[model samples]
Target: MNLPGHFHQAQYPKRARWFMAIVWALITVKCGVVWWAMPHWNMPTHPIWVVGPTLIFATLVTILWLAHREE
Candidate 1:
């Protein structure tokens, strides 16, 4: 889909796509770390409170990046 005035991966060079992929991977790793450490830290709230939003944001961005067209 074409989204006016929005940033899309296709609008960027191949190098940028790679960079974005790396950034997303790092974010995933961060979520994983937070998930694993949450129990050990004995936090009152569940890990999902923190990791859930990050994952959702990342997934939405990634989907938009892939779905966007260069119209």
Candidate 2:
């Protein structure tokens, strides 16, 4: 039997989705590490130290997400 129309459309390719999922997992882990280390790293004196990595990762995640979005 034929599938429903909505099921016919493709989503992100399997490889792309897996790659993004891996990246997302890594990002989350990195963020957790940063959160855990911020106190001992002497980064509290400069806010940029905290924000910089976060902004960089956020931008990367955004780019990856947009790249895989359906057009």
Maximum-lDDT candidate: 1
Error of 2 at 64 (Å): 7.0
- Residues 1-71 of candidate 2 have per-residue lDDT tens digits of 22233432255567866886787777777777776777777664554576578869778765655544443
In candidate 1, list every pair of residues with a backbone clash: none
Task: Please identify model 2 stretches exceeding 4 Å from their true place.
Answer: 1-9, 45-71
Instruction: After the best TM-score superposition of candidate 2, give how far the Cα of residue 6 lies from its true spot, in angstroms.
Output: 10
For residues 1-71, what per-residue lDDT tens digits would candidate 1 score against the true structure? 65566565556789968888899889989999999998998988899999999989989987787666655
Using Cα atoms with residue i matched to residue i, what is each candidate's TM-score against the true structure? 0.71, 0.53
Q: List the residue pairs that clash in candidate 2.
A: none
Best by TM-score: 1
